[model samples]
Target chain A: MKKKIICAVLIAAVILLSCCAILIQYFVGGKERIAYIYSDDKLVKTIDLNSVEQSYSFVITNSNGGSNTVEVRRGKIGVTQATCPDEICEKTGFIDSPLVPIVCLPNNLVIKISSSENENIIPDTVTR
Target chain B: MINKKIVSSIFGIILIIVLSSCNSQSVDNRAKESETDIFAMDTYMSLKAYGENSEKVLQKTSDKIKDLDEMLSVINEKSEIFKLNNANGEQIKISSDTALLINRSIEINKDTNGAFDITLYPITKEWGFTTGNYKVPTQARIDELLKYVGSENIILDNDNNLVSLNNHANIDLGGIAKGYAGRCAADIIKSEGITSAILNMGGNVQTIGAKPDGNNWKIGIQDPNDSSDIVGIVEVADKAVITSGGYERYFEDENGNIYRHIIDPKTGYPAETDIISVTVIGSDGMTCDALSTSLFVMGIEKSVEYIGTKHDYDVIIVSSDNKIYITSGIAEKFTVSSKFSEYTLNTI
Candidate 1:
């Protein structure tokens, strides 16, 4: 019985160690970050967040006279101002993950992020 | 006792080896799933394929989509639609693909009782939706444009692949192009022996098969009020989920009034409805794409009635009043997110 207990504990420890190794590798390894800005459903700019040394802001204007002010800082990006009535873009703040995007419907603008390693693998289209 | 100990020890060793093999196999399978995104049809499109030949299949599918974009785009000065639109009341020769799509559109228009019309291009252009310079046309101007907004005005001669427009009507395939492209992409992926894939054209989703792990794909439904929030999620397999919402594309006027891009062919105005978004799920992408727009314009009561008559697709309608109406066919597959829990959920 004592031998059996030792064997079970050994198996459990091995499983635990493997799980920790995977977690450490995933969280500790640096990930490459990229952000894409689209205006009127057209990709207008691509930014590598890791390469952004200084924070900057730019303006995007659509054909309908609508505009969005986008700000990019280290490791993150967001829309600071927009002419849309809802102001949803401004409220979205900064996004670091590719799961969500900053969108201004009135201006027809979207900002999305993705890891550089998986950047090419990012699906071509997302529908809301 | 010694024999029992040996048996248990051997079983433990086998279990360890099995577990380790599973971990490595999962990693290998993940690497096999390949994806690519392209810009076409004035929208972002993504294709993901799973299997050993995923990379090759994805590339071919992307090229197919690009080819379709060139052939069908109304805004492209050299496209078939553009050439046909510029024909000015004269019969023009069109490719069989274009003719087939037009014929399908005409059939759908008749089914929807003119709720969906391809000849609303003049009004769409006047509203500046096509050019992104939006202007609310006057009621009188809308009346003038309405005369040209009828699908019956389009005549197709299937024998010679000829198409003509009456009263100088112009055709725009913007409403159904993505869905059509998605359908064609699925065909390509399937022909390549890719059993599992997802084709997304600006929110029009077409699944080639169940997930490789034998699970349904979980698709999130965006909240019309909050762009970042997902109001619900639906599990689906081998299906298309197409959404049409006022929030998808719109412009704010100087007076702060928001006008959506979906023009109601009957009123010559942007569709005024209580529903903010409509998500349609079906086996065919084109039908889902067209119906999402048509049902959105139909509003709540009419949409429910119309859907009851049709049995091919199911819908989830999010109304401006914060209520979600899901048809019974997909109610079991859909889960309302916590953010929208306070809103009423009616399974019809």
Candidate 2:
């Protein structure tokens, strides 16, 4: 009698967990925040904003010379330091939205959020 | 026995639902796309066009940019523009590129009441805006250059591709060059069988057509007051959107006086106007680019009054007091950012 009760309860819990997962996947699968970093027009890195668990920093250097220091938080990315003369990329601050991209002209680097593959996504923006 | 059978059947039905739902999530297949980043014309340009011929279009654009930079650079000693500026009253045989740009600039200058003067290059150079070692020029020096700051002083024999300048005037195509480049890139893309693309040159964005899915591209105009926030979004197709704002580049003196890069041709100083930024949208990228700067100098009220009823293009002007004046032509196309609800919007 005890074994049968335990079996039924286990079956119910498994079914409930599966339902919860499908619901979560349906909501989460459509809107994805992805950032692509390009140097001299070549893509160097891609970050999934939703999955980032901790803050970190990285550096991108152009072979022709010049570098940019990128700092990443859970949902945003920014340039903290740069070898570019104006440091305009650093001044642009952190960007969470796909609309505005961070560009370091001197270093020949660009960081922009990707919305092309996000089918359910709307409102793609090009910032001035 | 009956209770156990019911529970087993329910469990089996739930498993099938889960498996079917997981399988039903579609993986979309999109059209081919080619995108590349290029640094040219003193800014980073991202060119992305869809279709199989897009790669060829990008290569052609890259080559054309190199040629354009060589021909139009005022700072490059060997550039055609430099040679003409130092021409010293002699008619230098110029390329069609120089003739076309100079002709358009003259027309814009007349139309904008000298607000779009190409001859303001000397004054701009004196302030070091081009080299970025920026400083405020003395009033006396500015006044000296002001005499040479008129497009009328430019002599162009359009029949023959020859150009000259009078009164020691110098011209720089920096303001309109990027837009023209974008326009050329667009033409190239279309010629190469790519229907949709964006030649985004820094603050200047020129689009080719609607996306493959038949949706207009959404462009965000950066807030002049706050660099990180967007003022609004504009939906566009086959249009060029260019923005000019004093806040984009400026220098501050020790006394906390700020001097901007856009030197007013009349005053020979950074434009002092009620307008903080001007964004122009039109089919012709060059016109939109020149108009953005010209309108900014015209101030919020004058711009509205100047562009009233013409409707050839649209403008979104943000004033110093944080009010937004959008042209009625693009009123439906623009949606202000919710964060900007604090400010009032007046559709012109």
Candidate 3:
């Protein structure tokens, strides 16, 4: 009876761990996190895949003397945010997907997203 | 025996359900990864439009645009109109590219009076806004350049194909040149098979086609008060959108007074108006860029009246209240979301 109980608990533990890992991979790995570029997280830029249209260009700057001009259309690329005024490195609009990063120049802020094919895999700690 | 079997089955089913749910989630996430192409440093102006073969095309196009910039710099140095070296009145021959831009400048100058003067270089230097060097100039110095800054003073002889500036005034196309380059790139891209692209030259933006899914290309207009908050999103399917804001370049005095770059030709001072930024969306990028600057200097009321006469283009103006004024047609196309809730979209 003791041996059976131990086996049951061990099996349940393995099942739970695997389930948690799968869950993390789905939620964290599949979709790129939308960057809420803000001065104080007040939702400065909503850079989610759903929100961005192909071939869109805009200038994003922060108060930190950083400014960047970003252009995204079909191909992904982010560049040219360094200007004399506010160099919000957000000028590099070149991220093709969520895996890449878009920066803000003046603010010295970096919002990173995933782009690699295996980006859907979640780590063990994060699965919880 | 029956009770033991029932308990075993129930536990097994529960475990399977939990396990399946997690497995499906992982599958769903991996399934949606979008495939995209990347164009790096090869992303010069005209090359962005060539689609798959854009890497090679971009290389060629960037070289061409850089060459154009160099040519214009040379023109700035030797043009008899600017006369950087000579104060004496002498007719100097210019390169064809410089002449073309000058001719275009002359037309805009003639049509808009001194409102769209390219010959404001001397005054621009006096204000110290051109090279990121900021300092308040004396009233006496501004007044001196103001006399020679009028676009009307520029003479364009179509017969001999020559151009001249009165009183040795200078011209600067920095405000309009990027837009022209964007338009040229758009034209080049359209010539190729690729139909969809966006030309984002600094604050000037132009769209070539709808999305790959054939939806309207949404371009967000930046809030003048807060660079992070979008004032509104403009739906530009096949058009150019350009914005000119008082916030782009400016400085604050000890008294906290703001001095901006967009100078009004009439007053020779930074345009002081309630409107914070002007975004013009039209068919041509260069036209949109020029008109946006012109309208910013013209102020809101007059600019709205001017826009009313044109049926094809649309505009959005952000005011001091953070209220957004847009054309009726544009209002119909955009969906007001939680982000723009604070902004009032007033249709002109």
Candidate DockQ values, in order, are 0.21, 0.34, 0.06
Instruction: Give TM-scores for every candidate, taking all chains together and pairing residue i with residue i.
Output: 0.80, 0.85, 0.66
Regions of candidate 1 where Cα sits further than 4 Å from its true position: A1-69, A73-76, A80-97, A100-111, A115-126, B1-26
How well is each residue in A47-90 modelled by candidate 2, as lDDT tens digits? 98767899999999998779999999887889999986556687
DockQ order of candidates, top first: 2, 1, 3
lDDT of 1 by residue, B245-334 (tens): 887567788999989889888888999998888999999898888888898888999999999988889999999898999999999988
Provide all candidates' interface root-mean-square deviations: 5.7, 4.2, 12.1
lDDT of 3 by residue, A1-128 (tens): 76567656766776677677777866666545344333322345655543456657676565654555555443344555556342324323344443224443234444434343333221100000
Clashing pairs in 2: none
lDDT of model 3 at position B175: 61
Compare the candidates by lDDT and give the number of the best one.
Answer: 2
Choose the strongest candidate by TM-score. 2
- Please provide TM-scores computed only on chain A for all of the candidate models, following their numbering: 0.67, 0.72, 0.41
The clash tally of candidate 2 reads 0
